[model samples]
Target: MLSPNSVYTSKKLGHYIVTILTIIAGSTVVATQINLGNRYRGFTITQLISSYNIFCSIILTSQFVCSVLELWSRFRTLNGQLLESLSCVGRPGLSQLLLGWRKRGNGEDLAARLRRLQHVHLVLQRAAELLQAHVSPAVTFHLMYSVVGIIYGSYELLVVSQAQNRAESMIISPSTSYSLCWLVHHLFDLVALTVSCSILEDEEMQASVLLRRAVGIEETVPQVEAFLRQIKRGPAICFTASGLLPIDRRLLVSAVSAATTYLIVLGQFGLR
Candidate 1:
């Protein structure tokens, strides 16, 4: 059986966490904008637009994040169960040594076990593909949303820093804080999504390794060989953002580099 950690046991924990964070962050953003609205009474239209934008962004980000968390939990359970099933077959080396001494029936039993594992792996692969398809669209939109928020926030922070000497520093400070807060939230979501997917990818790689080891080098059973061939020839089961980018640590590195470059360009423009 899979361990408790393999599956997400807390059924509503993700929902609770997302809801609590959304309320806190959403409230802070709205309240900050309202305070700024009062301070700058002349910019009524600007204040309303800002509030609307922030509200919509928060709602969309929250929805996507929650969906990802839920799907991730399901994926974790499926992966864990697969690993557990593989483990039940025991080590290939040990099985080989023991089966040689036992009755011929033991060899048949080992072959049966290998076939079952192959079936289980195929089922899990199908499930992962389905989950990937379900989440790709949301992931794509969330990524675009986050990138835009990060760019805008970075630019606003730069502008606010230059406003320190202005009479409206009080107004600028709150807006900057809101932007910074929004920026951090987006970064957190991106990091969490990528990290979770990376973990799953690593686990799947290990499982594939284990499957090969269990099959061993000397065994010539056609069923087992076919299973190995399937693993080698098949595409890797992993998450991708709208089938465009794999969700992994590499994506994080690229994202950070791109965001930094954009910020630098924005900074240069602000200076000019």
Candidate 2:
């Protein structure tokens, strides 16, 4: 009993799921080859896998830090605007005190308070933006990384196969790896999307209440829906621009393809 919109959304979600699975499968194949080659050259599978994870972690962490700084800068700008707005209004209910404080009191103290508020506001704003930008995508990335790790870890199977001179019996086919990786990625993305959507709905409800109070108009469902759509702008921009840029996608695919081919070749060689 799904509506047309619901059906379309489900189809779209399925497509993303397939894409992520392909990425995982490709990564696994590459990783397996890399690990096997290292092993053949006298490195243990554990050593190769550990080094790979360490490298990936460093890259991911650097990206995360840069994202945080960009978000922080945006928040600071927003907060400066809020403080400037407040300063223009100037000590709203205490006209006499304002004159006295502006002259006799340390102007520095008032400036400091304003600055502190600005900083606090900026930090809060940045945290909110970070949550909006990262929550779902981070979950998706983590899930994808986990699949990569698990499949890569399972190269121990290949190692054993090589050791026993039975590498052909334990080949990790691309399709098999891709299927498992895709399943994991899709499930994780679904969970992340559901949680993010729920939070967005709650935010929309709050915004509707505020709008109703300020404008003295009852908020209609359509109005609330429109507001919710507006809120999605940030996530949409982040995904399109920051999360899945063409360069990043190309690099990831290239790496996965290279790795998978290498592993297949190694498996064949080891069997001989």
Candidate 3:
């Protein structure tokens, strides 16, 4: 009786719901396992929590190293492409320079000046394009890895809470565990953002140096200084707005406070 499109839509919605439920069920099992492990092994919940973080840190570090290597490879590839493009325009060879100019300054032949200017412009434009392209994937990879690390950290936090049987220790509704998960997730994200921003800023400065060289400019310290200034200012403004501001700061703060409070309470009551 239903239209084909409607039937397809319903099926898709059903699959999505099923997927979500399955994830929830899987998480519940993991939490239960953590709780059982703590009980049977006679491990203090705090010890279990510490172990979880240690494990998560090891995993994140390995992934971070792999991501850095990948980023470096991409950066090298981008540099190679830019260099190849510059080579196509031909470098200022010794023979070309040996052809002495017949005139000086503004009196120089218009055609020659125009050619030099065109080459400069093309080099600058290509450098700009390459810089833009290089930044996009680096930012994307950082964000993707940060997000995954955040999720893993969140799961560890949730397991820690469950192991302690202090589910209500989270400030937000414990019924919506995902919200608490995200709060912890964002904390890890803040650290990742800072590290990634530093790496990107360094790469931008290097790219600027390469660009200046391509345009036949002497790569002076002042020019490098200016590039570093731009890198320091630009990405922070963009990344703060893009990454940090969107997170619920108040919720995160409250969750952290709650976590501390839970630790104190355990020390007083549970540990005693």
Best by TM-score: 1
Assess candidate 3 and give its TM-score to the true structure.
0.30
Scanning candidate 2 in windows of ten residues, the lowest lDDT window is: 95-104
Clashing pairs in 2: 21-182, 29-260, 30-259, 30-260, 33-263
In candidate 2, what are the lDDT values of residues 131-217, reduced to their tens digit?
A: 556644554565455445434534534555345454334543333343344334433333333333333334323332332332222
Per-residue lDDT tens digits for candidate 3, residues 213-251, read: 533433333433343344344432112223333222433
Task: Give candidate 2 regions above 4 Å deviation.
Answer: 1-42, 94-139, 143-272
- Candidate 1 residue lDDT tens string, 71-157: 455445544443343433445557545333132123435556667666766766776677778767867777777766667667667
Q: Which stretches of candidate 3 lie over 4 Å from their true place?
A: 1-42, 88-197, 216-272
Candidate 2, residue 15: Cα displacement in angstroms equals 38
Q: For residue 151, what is the lDDT in candidate 1?
A: 70
Task: Write down the worst ten-residue block by lDDT for model 1.
Answer: 98-107
